[model samples]
Target: MTANRTALVVRGGWEGHRPVEATDRFLPFLRENGFQVRVAETTEVYADADALATTDLIVQCVSMGEIVPEELEGLRAAVEAGTGLAGWHGGIVDSFRASSDYLQLVGGVFAAHPAVPADEAPAPGEEYFREHVIEITEAGRRHPITADLDDFTLRTEQYWVLTDLLNDVLATTTHPAEPGRPWRRPHESPAVWTREWGAGRVFVATPGHDPDVLDHPSVRTIIERGMLWAARGSG
Candidate 1:
């Protein structure tokens, strides 16, 4: 089939997250879905106006990379003018931390990934992988990306995010307030959500911590659908 869309995949940053492998897992799926996928290893791609303008979707997999002012502004402008942005885990929300403007555009930030509580802590090397339930919201059930998807559980990093009201939340995960913690009660965090940036769409899911997690059937489906859902002209 002739490709009808362009997906720019910008992947790099912390190797522990395995950005290259993580994004690579989805490249075939994107192509199968009619996207002419282009891979980039740096955030510098965001600074090229012509490239950004022609692109229909961006699948970012960079974790904690520095994006200078010009690059960030170019990205911001493209999204505002109809270039879609979609990503998961630290690739989207945890990156470019020093840029407040970038945080505001994405509508959320990776505040923390608290380890499993002591009472239920796992083996010595697996302390940080907290098992948690991801509940799909009513809005999610009706949304194309997550429709008919059941509530699922994950045993990877459970992200604790800080988000705003402007987002249309699709799924959520909760952090039980352990006795010794600062908060008094359980804190609910958005596991998946979407945002409108002027003429563009933004989709984010906090579940994918690595390639294996992204390969989870439900996770893979949601992310694939989300990339399309975020692209320009999604029905």
Candidate 2:
């Protein structure tokens, strides 16, 4: 029999996490789970009018960049037509700052990352690098993606997003940069969240920062489950 699903992977932009490396790790997982995967290097895949019609899922690893309107529309239409879309880190949310339509569809956009200090700041080269301890929210406990996982931590980027359209938030991580300092504020960040866009499933994990980041057992498990759930009712 043919594979049960089709996953289209698009990787490009900022080479920090090595988008290709992440996609490399994801390919086997998809195939073992019975998905025939297609790999693309640009947003142009969405330019095809019939693109999403045959896609089971769209896995994007592209960082901040410009995308053509036709390409963006094709993607929008695909998801609206019931194709699953999944992404991690800045690739999805922080992408296309000029496109309000894209940002609205993604639910959240990256604002200032105060934790990442500026170069001319008093701290200079010093950065707020710490072990991210995440707490699974109440809604996460009922979801298959985070069902058995307990509170976990990872050495990765902790996203501080302004989002309100998520359906089920799978996990949250808090960053405490200071103690008792009035100017310092504690932030509760969302590490993983799932939402629905039109008739399709949208899953995003804002944790992947490097090759080893995904190596974390908890991190890997969550991403795996998110992929599956995002592809719900499709093949």
Please write out the lDDT profile of model 1 over residues 6-43, one tens digit for every residue: 99999998888999889989888889988899999998
How does model 1 fare in lDDT? 0.92
- Candidate 2 on 117-146: residue-level lDDT in tens? 344343532254445687898889988889
**TM-score on alpha carbons, each prediction:** 0.97, 0.89
RMSD of each: 1.1, 3.2
CA shift at 116, candidate 1, in angstroms?
Answer: 1.8
| Poorest lDDT segment (10 consecutive residues) of candidate 2 | 117-126
TM-score of 2: 0.89
TM-score between candidate 1 and the true structure: 0.97
